[model samples]
Target: MTKPTEIKALVFDVFGTVVDWRSGVAREAAAFLQRHAPHLDAFEFADIWRREYSPAMEEIRSGRRPYVRLDVLHRENLVKVLKRSGITGATDAEIDELNLAWHRLDPWPDSVPALNRLKRRFIIAPLSNGNIRLMVDMAKRAGLPWDAILGAEVVRAYKPSPQVYSETVDILGLAPAELCLVAAHNGDLAAARRLGLSTAFVVRPTEHGPDQKTDLNAQQAWDFVVDDLNELASQLDASID
Candidate 1:
């Protein structure tokens, strides 16, 4: 193992990393469809909606469009997806309600307990691209014990950008080395590492479900690569004390 650094807090990526957004969102969408459009194939529709996520974000990242919240992106794509799948007659109120499904995503089986352990030792918070409202709602819904919530919405920038990470550390009144970025995504860890923050990779192989194709394992030598957050907590506790 690499020599541990003076880490005092661990900020995490929420969607797909801490929570099983793909499966949970798909399940919720399916239930909504079954109740509203019984003849529609909810599973297929869910997959279609998810497939649009990256491209939608890319448009903003590439400067082809202005930045929009994930909720807006999800709703825009949902409308097209529902229409393409021949589902009709849904009212605006119903569509608005459906857009909130992301907020109710379920955490991975080990997430809550692992987070609980980690929280006992260090300041634990979510540093995700999700807006504050979305993060707060999700935390409440999933029983996530976050000490504070930080996100792109608060800083008006997203991950892989040094500003968001730096801002988070500054706000927490900690130096870069005093903070660790715990995420399942290598790209996110790489960004944090570049900005002098310690990194921990917690693998979530099935984050994209059975058809998952990326982030199967840690791609770089992070400060720590533990099996899960619980193990991560143990490792950190042993290292610092």
Candidate 2:
């Protein structure tokens, strides 16, 4: 295990780890549905849209499709979501507006405070699958104190893909052992650990909603495991502000 003192930077998974994508997307979907498809379930719509995330990225990861920003994929998925819901009359403008929901996600209550604290001691940034614009928009709206954003767009690949982890560490000019991947998903940690990076699991049991069965706890003996980013900051001895 890499010593905690040797970990100079902390990179995070953004969607479910730093922000509550589920609730925020659902809220936006609810408002859009209220105007266009009031009969549909907003949460269900949000879930369906999120379900498409992995498969879409797999296209790029598997080299079946060239890399594109997440925004494009979200718009494409939004069209499918609307059609699946039997609402095909949405204008291109409305579809574009609705797709911005990913940018409007709200952070968990402890996110801002905890990230601010963590930033005091180490270089902190997002190693998310989200594209630059998406991450920038989210950070600005949510007061996330990312020193920089590094992820799929930078590497032209997605998480669990070795390059996404290795390239990011390369971009940071750090030895793999000098950086820690902080994420709520155990699979993400597993990916980083395999690449010789330190790993920290910050559990978010509600990320997939109340009935969420997966990723409810750390799946491995990660270097650090905590209930939330706040606990993670405490574990790292990053004092609260």
Candidate 3:
């Protein structure tokens, strides 16, 4: 077993970890589909769109495509999904506006206060796959108190890619062990752990959906396992005051 690093900064994974993307995207997609293609199941449409998120980026990760911002990937995927839903009448402007749903996501209930508490003790930033613009927009709207926005665009690579996490530590001038990757997903933490960064798994059972089968709980003996960000703040000894 590897000894965990003396944690100082907390680099967060934003999608399901920080903000509630599933609900947010589902809400927006429902509205869009209701207005345009009422026959389609908007909620399921939202789910299917999110399902395409990874494979779209996986192409870039696998060197099958060049690196592009997440917005571009999302737009491409959105169009494909819309086509499948028989909503091909959507204008380019409408498509672009719809894609911005990712930017308008809401934070989980515990995210703001917990992050504020954690911010008292550690340097907190979003180490997300979303680009800087997307993160900045979400942070401003969701009131996420991040000391910095660090992630894929900053490193030009995605998570589990190593370079993403390595560049983040390098940018902070902190050793791998000093930075703890706090996240809801096991894969994200597993990648950080393999790189010698301390890990915290916060369970987000509804991140996928109510009936979600995966990531219902922590999949590893991580440094800290908690129900939400507030518990994480408490576990890390960050005072609410």
Candidate 4:
């Protein structure tokens, strides 16, 4: 395990790590669909809509398209998914409301208490691919107490780019070793580790639901592996004491 000696701040991945995005988005989409398009299969629609995320991101990453925020990507994908599912009559205004669904996701049950504990010892913030406005709005709506919000929009690059991770440290006025990237996704940790940042893997095994195909566990020897955010806080507190 890497020593936490210089670590002064902890950055977290918001979706599926700190927050239950899948379930939260699913619930909201379902409610909206039932209210508006009663004939549509909300559950199937939600799942299909989320399934489009990776491909959409890939398009941007490959330079086949211009870079767009996750919120815009989600909205574009949602339109296609809704149309494919035979649900019609969605106005542009309604689509805009649905796009904001990502902004209102609920944090995991343990997130608040755990973050509060960590906040007492270190500067805690979100280091996510989400844009600044999205992260700020989500934090506000979900009651996530973050000292600051860092996102790809600030650096104009996404995670796995050393620039983004390094820039975050620079902005925080901390050394690379002085910040830990806490995330449920191993790919995210891998990126941070390669860039000399401390890493913590908090397992969110059910994050993708029963059909989970990736990130079952920490794939590398991360600095720490814990059951949840609460456990992560306990370990950090113990280290300090």
Give the Cα error of residue 97 in candidate 3, in Å.
0.7
Best by TM-score: 2
Q: Top model by lDDT, which number? A: 2
Model 3 over residues 42-117: C-alpha lDDT tens digits? 6688789988988988898999998999999999999888777777678888888999999999999999999998
Report, for every candidate in turn, its global Cα lDDT versus the true structure. 0.84, 0.91, 0.88, 0.85
Measured against the true structure, the TM-scores of the candidates, in listed sequence, are 0.91, 0.97, 0.95, 0.93
Question: Order the candidates by lDDT, highest first — what do you get?
Answer: 2, 3, 4, 1
Model 4, range 1-241, lDDT digits (tens) per residue?
Answer: 6666567999999888999887877787876788767776655666788889778877766668877788888888988987787777878988898888889889999999899988988999999988888999999988899998886778777676678799998999987888999999998899888888999999988887877888888899999899999998888877778
For model 2, how does the per-residue alpha-carbon lDDT over 19-100 read when each residue is reduced to its tens digit? Answer: 9999999998888899888988888899999999999999988999999989999899888878887897788988899999
Across 54-105, the per-residue lDDT of candidate 1 in tens digits comes to: 7887787666887778788889999998788777888898888888988888
Query: Cα RMSDs of all predictions?
Result: 2.0, 1.8, 2.1, 1.7
Q: Whose TM-score is higher: candidate 1's or candidate 2's?
A: 2
The candidate 2 region of ten consecutive residues with least summed lDDT is 232-241
> In model 1, which residue pairs have backbone atoms overlapping below 3 Å?
none
- lDDT for 68 in candidate 1 is 74
Q: Model 1 lDDT vs. the true structure?
A: 0.84
For candidate 4, report its TM-score. 0.93
Q: Alpha carbon lDDT of residue 188, candidate 1?
A: 90
